[model samples]
Target: MTVLVTGANGLIGRALCERLQQKKQAFRAAVRPGVPVQPGCDVAEVGELNQATNWCRALTGVDIVIHLAARVHVMHDKSADPLAVFRTVNVDGTLNLARQAVDAGVKRFVFVSSIKVNGEATKMGRPFTEADAPNPQDAYGQSKCEAEQGLRQIAMDTGIEVVIIRPPLVYGPGVKANFAALMRAVQRGWPLPLGAVHNQRSLVALDNLVDFIITCMTHLQAANQTFLVSDGQDLSTTELVRGMAQAAGVSARLLPVPVWVLQAGAKLLGKGDAVQRLCGNLQVDISKARDLLGWVPPVSVEEGLGRCVRG
Candidate 1:
């Protein structure tokens, strides 16, 4: 099957492309203009992912399209209208590509969405499942929810299979943003005030996510289904920090600070949302994926963290 992978230069995209190449899968990489073409792969320069951006060259003769390009969530968004900006790329742009893919005779479209579409966090012991109604808490989440809805509608109208995979906090080698920063902090032996905070969060390794995506590409059970994917291992903030320290062969200097005090400090500094993420319960149940597709995360949490730190 010929697959078209958009956002070929992104963290997940780069890894997915490498895996595809290793497996000898016939695929094309869709990158934005000016980005260097990936050597030894079929590359297409699809400029400016938006409602009007042309995807004809990328979708040509493709059997499947993995839509990974989107306006990812920003912690400190400087846009005047954040929701509108998100909608332009995540909603409008996604639907545009799906519609064009249908015209290109693509049989399946796999969309990589975020767990934020389920909400910022779940209640303790009440992990999010595919049955949960969408409760998007941010502009980026809302846009993804809209895009999913639009894609479903398109699937119904055109008979093209749609598969949606929502992953939570994907991390592994080459990870950046908060996860990477935490690793650096732990490596530097910085004392972290998360010794007492015990909130569970689910994370997916980059390899596991890529493997699941490849499975969905041809798995008949994956069609028309929304799957939540993770490493099936949950960790608290303290445990996560300690694990990083262990991987780096360093001691984690954790301060036993109260969660309420941290919350108060974050609120005072206008970082309440950020702190909540660090000290919140955001877990997803991946039983649907396991039972339906017989898919399992090949890499364990310990191994995934080790690879991340080593990288």
Candidate 2:
């Protein structure tokens, strides 16, 4: 079956393309104009993802569409209307592609959503599950929730299959943003103030996420389902930092500052959100993906962290 992958140059997309090529899968890469891709790739230049964006050319003869292109979460958004900006790309653009794909006789659409769709953080020992009602806390999360709702409606209206996968923070060799910065800081032996913070966070490796996405492409049981995925392991912030440091061949020098003090400092510095992310209890339960699909993370957290550090 022919497949189309949008945002083909992104971290997860790059790894996915490499895996698909290794497996000799027939696929096309959808990217913006002027982006460098491998030679001889079936590239579709779908510029500026939004409501008005046209994807007819890209969806031609494509049996499966993996919708990964969206207005990603920004740490410090400069947009005056963040919700509108996210809706234009994440919600409207997603539905546009879904409708066009349905019209093109595509069988399945796999959407990569964020765990933020469930909520920012889970209560201690109360991991998020697929059955949980959506409680999006940010514009990005709200847009994804809306997209999922729209896609479900599209599926009902058009009989095209829809699979939604919500993954927590994904990290790997080419990871960027906060996870990458954490790796760099660990490699540099920077003293972190996470010794006293003992919050559990779940994360998925790039390989694991890619494997699951590939499985959902043609798995009949995956149709009309929402799945939460992770590495099947949880880690405290201090343990994660220590593991990263170990992988980087450095010592984990941690300061034992209380979580309350850190929260106060973050509030004083207007970085409360940052601190919440760093010391938050955000765990996802992947029992549905495991029990229903018999899927397991191919890579362990230790191995994933090693590759991230080595990179």
Candidate 3:
């Protein structure tokens, strides 16, 4: 079967393509503006997802479309209309491609969604399930929530199977953004006083996530289903950093700084969000994927972190 992967140059996308290549499967990759292409993967660029011209050519002979292109959020965005922009690209653009996929007789549409789409629940220690209420707090998450709604409606109308994978804090080799920063800091041996802080966050390895994508590609149980995936294990912040440092062949210079003090300091510096992320409650329960799909995450948390460090 032929498959199409959007955002093929991205961290997750690249890993997914590598896995698909290993299986000797026929796959096509969609590259958008500002994203580069990897070696050995069939590359196709569509200028804009909203325009009909963009959808017309990309969907030809495409049996499956894994929609990963979206307007990701950033701290540097100064736009007051971030939500509008997110909706345009994520919700509208996503639906445009889905429409084309249905027209092209594509069987499955796998959507990569964020854990934040279900809200940033912190500290109660309860894991979010597929049946949990969607309470997205930010514009980006809201846009993804809307995208899921649109996809669901189209699937019902067109009988195109839609599978949504919600992953939390994905990190691996060649990662960028916050994960890159963490690696840089670990390599530099920053004496962070964060060991005393305790928070459990679910993180997914890139390889395991890619494996999940492959599983969803042919698993009939994935159709019309929403899955929350991780390494199937949760890691605390201190454990994560210490593990990362160890994997990097460095020592974690973590000190015992109380979570309350950190929050107070963040409030004083107007970095409340940063504080929240560092000591926030982000967790998920992937029991459904295990029970229904008979799938297992291929890499352990430590193994994945080790690969990132070695990379």
How many collisions per candidate?
A: 0, 0, 0
Cα RMSD to native, each candidate?
A: 0.8, 0.9, 1.4
Top model by lDDT, which number? 1
Residue ranges of candidate 2 with Cα displaced over 4 Å: none
Between 1 and 2, whose lDDT is larger?
Answer: 1
* Ranking, lDDT, top scorer first: 1, 2, 3
Q: Candidate 3: misplaced stretches above 4 Å?
A: 33-35, 51-53
The global Cα lDDT (0 to 1) of model 2 is 0.92
Model 1 residue runs over 4 Å out of place are: none
TM-score of 2: 0.98
Candidate 1 per-residue lDDT, tens place, 1-311, comes to 89999998899999999999999999999998788756898999987878998999888899999989888999789999999999999999999999999999999999999998999998888999999999999899999999999999999999999999999999988899999999999999999999998999999999999999999999999999999999999999999999999999999999999999999999999999889999999999999999999999999999999999998
Which window of ten consecutive residues has the lowest lDDT sum in model 2? 36-45
lDDT (0-100) at residue 163 of candidate 2? 99
Model 1 Cα shift for residue 295 (angstroms): 0.7
